[model samples]
Target: MKKMTRYRILMLFSLMIVGITAHSEPYEGVKDIALRRFPWLAKALVFNVIPGIDGNEVFELSSVKGKVMVSASTASAAAEGLNWYLKYYCNRSMSHFGDNLNALAKLPEVGKKVRVVSPYSHRYALNYCTISYSMSFYTWKDWERELDWMALNGVNLMLAPVGMEGVWQNTLRKLGYNDQEIAGFIAGPAFGAWWLMGNLEGWGGPVSQSVIDQQVLLQQKIIKRMKQIGIEPVMHGFYGMIPSSLKNKQSIKVIDQGIWAGGFKRPDFLLPEDPYFDKVADIYYSEMKKLYGEDLHFFGGDPFHEGGSSEGADLAASGKHIQKVMQQNYPGATWVLQGWQQNPANGLLAGLNKDKTLVIELFGENTNNWEKRHGYEGTPFVWSNVSNFGEKNGIYGKLQRFADEVYRAKNSPYGSFLKGVGIIPEGIYNNPVAFDVMLELGWHVDHLDLKKWIGNYTKYRYGKSNVNVDKAWALFLETAYSSPEVNQEGPSESIFCARPAIDIKTVSSWGTRKRNYDVAKFEEAVRIFVTASKDFEGSETYQTDMIDFVRQVQANKADQVYASMIDAIKSKNAGNFKSSSAKFRQMILQQDSLLSTSKYFSVNRWLQQAINFAGTKSDKANALWNAKTQVLFWGPDNNPKTDLHDYAHKEWAGMLSSIYLRRWDAFIDREFAQITSGNVSEPDYFKMENEWVKTGELYTLKPLKKRERDGLVKRILANNQ
Candidate 1:
């Protein structure tokens, strides 16, 4: 009787343990991401989490009874395994522009168990500027897709400084600062990146409390989703940046960081030695923990970022004190620093605990700072590429250079501290191929042959490999995507996006107008790419690429017209000038029509996104203003001649029609009149631009029908040829 009673109790306990294990699904988040993105495939997929192989994330792919099985050591690895199967076996993929994740009739059989293991300790994504340039007005829906893509691409660490406004607001409130003073500290939605970097303060703001609260909620959701997918959120760290007004409030040693570019005053640097510094930092971290959980492990901030003054301070002590406060709040946290243009100074390095720090080489495409600085003075660092600036529309990436550099870094003498690889584009909206190749390098142990890789990329990117498509990609490899040993910021600047000038060398201040690749060769590739359009009419990815390629050819032709018009101006040929100027204006209008065929290149879509994110009427107005200003004048309201104007220029459809078109018209009409009848009047371009921003007009247009779009492409190609 006693033995039977003991057996019954043991059985009950065993059953209870089974119930708990069944409820806890470790791979559930990744499964949900797969389902939400590729609903058809998700239902036929099986996921299982197993132990890691030698402390590195691993995934095994196979097919069992017609269902795709992905067994991984972690959720992120499972998502990557699912991506690999989709790309290689299924011939489907996702990108920033569009997705090719259509339903398959049947699951493709993985005949053998295929396994992949990432060699890097960390895989990171995003830039501080990406917060404004690519994702300033992102809603939860946008974030959902962003995080989903991150998981599939194996991004385990991402910079996410989204809701710092609320943190600052609460921290200031606790420190006896008024609402008005706090308002002066926070920047607007479109300009938060600069604010967070300590380059400027209150330039685009005096934001409503409602928007602040909304961002706080949005950040909460973002962090929650990221944690589930196994991606660490690198929140903004407090690095002694205080308002310039803080001097009037308290007696403390403050270094005046006088001014930044575009005449904006930089925030004052608080001496880390001051007692007030510790007090303020404690409150700041406490509020941050209250808002975002204490489970955070990484923080990103740079002292003296982007030419800010770090005058009259002990560099070594300041660095140590900053990291000390951070460690005090969150034990074992890593302080992530940007290695760009003489940053993470040697003195600062001398003070840091190397084990608790990670540096990101921000300009790997153009600079070999890692080698130059000896792997950031032996501190753990990630090799990174900042391929695009301001998210400019250009077909540019040194595909071979990317592969060569990553391979070189991994095998270099300083390889011991080379922690991982990452993509830190100022804008992540363009050049999807560049990012895909960079991220996938983490999984590769051997150096890649980019030529063969391009063929495979073409296959998965468009859902099939055609002879014409393959030929075009080869031409692409030699032309725009070619790795020439030259220093260029992004793809060649579009002449159409340039602010109207007779001798314009670049569209933005630091951008270039020179095409380093062969324009004719690029055109030939576009020609061949168009030939496969008939086979891929139903593929969204193909259609989008077709529009983009054809658009590049149009931009090339605009450069020719611009040169002819300038030559006419210099030679005093009024008739030639008139014809060339008219042609340029007509091309701008035509380009707008061409871009209208895709929402990806539509300015109306961007504005709509900004408007849709706002809850109140006032918020809507502010959001719209923020959106328009950012892509155009990007201003300090008072500085009309600010060199920062058109720094974040876009070549979108409605933007050309509404903003650039008008600017060109004003300039051209005046120039033509001056040439023909000696009437000279300079247009107040800054005033004209600001007026356009306040119009509240959305230049919405229906996308052209397929037949119309095809005809437009053909017309453009023929005219350019």
Candidate 2:
């Protein structure tokens, strides 16, 4: 009996030690990513967790017995360390355009043990607009790929407001609201980002119940994946954005938030001080918990996004009450606020607990909101950049500015409150380099000189670097990716995608047609980049970039043609106008053909993805319409001259030939008539745009053969020079 008891005690003691050792292993999530993405290298890689110095996340890389060993404080850090080795040593990388994550013949040796400590605690990603612009049609497969990328890049916090449609539906229904009423409150999939931001109530939808249910399932999967990888999702939280019609049915003290941009009616705000506030907030969070889960820690909702009335309400007390309700439901939850164009008002800031609130400085590249607002009045803030807007196609990013601003913010007077860095691009699809550099900054304490940094970037990005490729990037940094101390919305707008106008000031509203960099330098870079085609013929990353650079040159040429046409119109040179306009039309056709060579630049991919996401034929049609309308004329339907038209413009293959070129044809013909004769005709573009969306044409990819694509690229580059 004594021997048996001693044996049991020893067994229990051994089991406890085993558990401790297992728990101390490097995060399994990071290991999972390695197995899934780089199976060839995974078997040779060992991961182990190490204590971080002074509560900061850190990663170490070393080689042990012919194996790559990664040690880190967290899963995100482990993933970053793995990526660091892949890029610096293996000369391989991944991006949205294409990944060069091919099987390695042998693992790269780490000659010296390398260690990196992250200064920032919170590395964030996504903008409200990013959900719609970049990922509206994403499926579980798409999201899985995205989450893997996010984890690898060390994104610990991400905005995930997808399943809120069901949450609101349940909350409103339980509060005695009918189905029809609930339908009116939920926006369509493409418009959910704006809807969540309290900009509009229902524009893209009267969404079907099944689709809403699908969103719930999708969000559950998303958050699950995010949590597994150590990323905390910023789920949509209740911030008094109720339907305006709720006032008629209930006794809540409602503040009407009149109209949003593009003529959509804004949702009403329930006064947080009202007795109904607690009850409605309770139902909202309860429904949220029932739909999502109980482990959520971060909540995102902005009241008065862009512009909305706060009339007859105590702003300070209202902020306090709103935050209190969130804490009551999810204890120790953080209220994530956007610092953009006078938001998180001083009155609002005065009432919140500084430790529990995080402000995202949305426009870090152009505006120093973090610095200007004195670190959001000394509240914890993350510096973020919105490099791309509306997913517009053009090569742009102030690469050095991103690194400079982040380092500056970290060392500034409010450095103590500067929590971390983030990539808040309204659209994430366009610039891979921008996102890559910005995210990597979180791992560094000092700023990186982009001139030196992009050399290693080119080596990894294209699998190997050539001298011509290196020279092209040097000019790329001087031109497209140059850091000019001027405020710009996004990449330079392509005049090819612009609405036809003799005096074109901008393409979409708030977007400039100005190629801020020297166009000749950019064209020269394109010419040099094309020279490496033979060397990198099998490289998808090189090919995609080549297509983009050539496309930008075509866009720049269109600008010249446009200038000539306008000059002819002004001087009554009808012959010159006719020739220039004809050239412009031909250029659009060629541009369409060039864009067709990649799925990334195909409008068919967008429409087909949307249609594929739906079940019923009617749902597919609705989804297709939503897809078309969003890219062409993001609308309120009644407003013809809506500023929102073409705001999400793509210089895509199908879009150019089918919609933009068609609209331009009508306008050009009208101009020709007015110039040749005394006839003044106007193209009703709004009607044309609406008709195009209803056409129900599902465009398909027509990728050109490599020989044909290369020839076309060569011809375009030669002609431009």
Candidate 3:
């Protein structure tokens, strides 16, 4: 009876294995597309192991024909591997998944049960925000968009490292780091923008401990979801940088990053050679393993990301020490470095294990140093673009260069070391098309028809199928998407107050204003934008985007008029000044209205530029002095003993004082001129005008009465309303 039971158990286990394998086949046509687009990548990575027809679908592994099916566990691993391959090679671009999935389903050999995983929630309200301490995770809707992109382009690996703060806190505490220290290390919620930039440090904190704890739980959920979809998670790794509190208990050398000029001490950098380094590394990794599990193969961290010191140590040796500790703790671990701003010292690559290191050529579209240096002497590298800054809304990119460079890299002598491509923007919300085009490039290395691809993209992005929308996109491609020679990181500047808006008389860093922009081309682009806006007139997203686009159009128009005025000023042409100032003021007023219309827009930067332009154009030193003072109070970066409400009162006082100073000067000059002319009416005129000015001044000085103060409060609050 025991022998019979054992035989039955063996048979049951076999059936279960076969059942799991039966359901885990790759989508039909995925392998064919993968092989055709990325022959080298497919050759190295794809592995097929099945040949069967359950219905109309066919099953194959790594392009091979077989029936040695994949179990659920094996399928999950394969998915992760695929994701890594896609991100590393393709740069996490997006594509049309709905059409691709439908096409896959229609294949004669594909089974009805096989379906690509959906990362979206059916209800939009419930999934609009990703629940996490870190806001980097896409909300369910965004995740669905990403998943659709992934499936269409055949991405199986994804890096979902959202909500990792709690994991770090728990780990640090185990290693004897205190709450104060941990708090200092973590960034404030809003400043995640700068934290990602490797700029600014813990400016918005002391973060609540509850937030950290919440992130830990959230990360577990994120990892689980990613796993189910066959995407791999790349967790944060320990580099030598840490919170200043670590210095108190651990004997490690620290470099103060100095105050970032915003009244906060920057995070300190720890030296890798310190004896305490290993202890910290162990605690960090051990904690990561305990919280997220040890299944992850890739880790991301960088030394001296934006700016830091390697003053006392050998740069090469220091890098090796850091990598050595990471590898010792997690075997076969991949060390991911961002090739940003000359940090990680090219010298450091010499000491690190070449095969285990991965370099992200972070600004590939803008910089070619990674390829030029040949991955700093043969370290594996991937091309990437930071296409956006501060994730600001605007449309711009080196479209042709994106295609040209990727092709060049693939055909270069150092091509073998080029692993893949990626998009690493500080803000990922804008530029939907740029992201789509970049990711799709990974799936198609040859015979790329960009126009057809964009036509499909237009339908998918708007979540609709419309002919008019397709026509609008074609116009957009011809205008906004057309490549320009300017070495800009993102879109053209708007005349709005968030960015500097100088008069044409003043040359910007890019040289002459006329040379900076092509007015004729820009006008055409604006027309295209207006036409596109008509199609999505009622869309909230479209309207929000239009607000920025319209301002940019206004700025471009102002630039042309301003340039002509500046030339007239230089030629001593006085007639244009009044008209020029009126145009400038019109631009300012237009921006003010836009900013007032929504809480989203701010005009601080524009105000500062106006002040700068006034100072440069006016000959009188006093005029320049007044403009500078105005900026100090009203500029975006101002700190007048409190927040915006307090600053507004102070600004009103400053403006009154400035007007009084100008009036006082005029009074003295007028009295002198009247005395010189020997006119008796002069004394009477001076007395009358001076008395009126004094009355005006007295009215301004009358201390704010309760009712008056209440009115002011109402007006201030009304700005938001």
Candidate 4:
């Protein structure tokens, strides 16, 4: 009998407790998730688990006595079967946009058995992440709907970093840090993911212990739900990332990760070469096991993530030791790495054990890194589509390219490394078609014809089809959303969401405002899409899309106004300048009004969720500050040195009329005053922007019926033309 250490003793105790309660059935929560989202489907359909090949989890459907039947080997594959019945037979469908289901109607008679076997073992979701920006404050209620959305779309592996700050809090305190010191280390709800990965640190601090404790409990619930639904929740792994303050005290060799996004202190990387690294990694896992339990299999963390300093480091040794630490505690675990922006470097991949590692080819839409890097140097990888960056609202996706690329890689020489496919939007709400089409590739055996697929998609999307809607989508395929003939990142940034400038370089710091598609042709498609609005007026999905499309049209029209303003300034004509400025201001107000009609476009909903996330008044204020800053002026707070302003800018209703409009109004006033007086005047935008950041502004958060935006969409379309 071997003597057990204290941590080892706790692990055994936990195992004994967990053994009694653990259920081994894989597809446990398939029905519960379905009932939560679509209760009516329970009466119409049935799901069961059956044994099959590992990657080839199968879902088969049959009909008897007017009852639809389903048999699936996994929860997600079962949901896919439910999805198939919803789309092909019943013509009722589910999408990221919304659902189109008619409970009163009967399922179409299934004469032939409809069976779909997923070819890939992994179909994943999220980035590292704008889910923080878009939905950090999301409660279990919000998550219930989202998890249902994930299951319906067949997302099996998801980045569920909901409450990692709590883990960090407990982990650090046990490592000899005071509560105040620990508070300074953990970021707020908005910046939790980035801080966890060692990119930037302590920008959104000092988080309270109560919040941290609350989050630990919340994460337990999130993981439980994820496991139940057959989705493997990827939690933040401890890869020797400690606070920068850990230097010069302990004998441990801590490599300073330095600054990221200008002047924000990056967490010091704990050198695996140092023997003290094992101590930190040990306690971290011990604490993690206590809070989250031990059934977890996937761990996500990157050391030199997006410009972390790599001095005093051995790359190969670091990778090996990090993965070793993770495997030692959590047996037979897979290390999930981000294949983004020169990450999982040749040396890094060389160190990782091939069988136990999986790399997310994150920028698959833009870069051919997997092929160039020899499928992450022949290590197993997922060919993922990260279409949306920062979750900016844009009607853009490389739809045909996604189907083409995923299929092309599947049959390529290095095809064995291509283990799966995924939808990795930094934020997920925008581009329903982009996500819908990508996830479907998991079940596909060959190349998909997006042109033909759109016909079926439109029918299922709106619960029925219309000739005009079909024609509009035909034009859509060739224009607005057509895969760029050249390389493009995400969607065009809307000028309405941009900081006020006549010749704005880019909407976000690194993003472009240039429309890659032919604007005029896309406008024509929008006009045609609106023609069939009455038929799809009942569709929440269609109406939601219409409002989004109309907003895009109006945003595109603002380009002409911007051009007119620039021309007036160059020509030194005050009359033209005043005229263009007024038109620009009016457009902002109209855009706000149009957006207010839709629930999804409400800024109030976002900010209010942030406020509600906190307990006390001070925490609520802090939460609101963090919320507003992320979407409007991404911050290090009032500092002129920060270049992150407008990085995550949203073009939502309340945001437009409130912050953006106010900023533009001030810019136009100062510029108009100067240009008219025969003097060139440049407004001090940074000064004005800094002042706005400190102001306590709030937006209304109320839901409205889609009908409110009915006439408004037409008016926007009519005026833009």
Per-residue lDDT over 437-472 for candidate 1, one digit per residue giving the tens place of the 0 to 100 score:
999988887998898888889889999889999999
Mind giving the per-residue lDDT tens digits that candidate 3 earns over 1-721? 9999999999999999999877764532333334444343443443343322222112222212321122122333233334333433232322311121111111121222232221110000000011111123234444544543444333434445555576667767886877887776766443443443334555444556654555466667666655544445566677776666667776678776654323445566677777777877888888888888887876767666556555676778878888898898789888877677785577888889989887767666678876668656888776767665433335566656677777788677887777666666544545656766665555444535777776655544443445655665565565556665555555554322211122422211221222234445544544454456546644444444445445445555655555554555455455564456455545544433443332223322222322332212331222223223222222122332211111111112222233322332343334334434434222232232233322312112223443443343233223121
TM-score of each: 0.97, 0.97, 0.64, 0.93
Off by over 4 Å in 3: 1-12, 20-161, 174-177, 193-199, 255-265, 462-479, 498-517, 525-551, 561-721
| Tens-digit lDDT track of model 4 for 1-721 | 3555877898989998778546453354877765665677666665556776665878888997877777888887887777777787767776656678766455577788877778888998888775686678887777777887788778899888777776777777787888888877788778886787787777677777667777777788888888777789988788878888877557778878877884677889999978889988988888889889899999989889998877768888899999999999998889899998899888888888989999999988888788998988989999887777777888888888889899999999889899899987888878888888999988898789898889999988887879988998888888767877666667888888877876886888778888888888888888899988878767888888887888888998998898898898778788999989898889898788887877678777777788778898778877877777677666676565467777777888888887788778877887777776756566665676655555666666443455555666666777542
By TM-score rank, best first, the candidates go 2, 1, 4, 3
> Where does candidate 2 stray beyond 4 Å?
1-14, 17-26, 719-721
How accurate locally is residue 693 in candidate 3, as Cα lDDT from 0 to 100?
A: 24
The models' CA-based lDDT, in order, is 0.89, 0.89, 0.49, 0.80
Q: Which regions of candidate 1 are displaced past 4 Å? A: 1-19, 719-721
Relative to the true structure, candidate 3 has a C-alpha RMSD (angstroms) of 14.3
- Give the range of the ten consecutive residues with the poorest summed lDDT in model 1: 712-721
Enumerate clash totals for all models, in the order shown: 0, 0, 25, 0
User: In model 4, which regions exceed 4 Å deviation?
Assistant: 1-28, 53-55, 678-684, 687-696, 701-711, 719-721
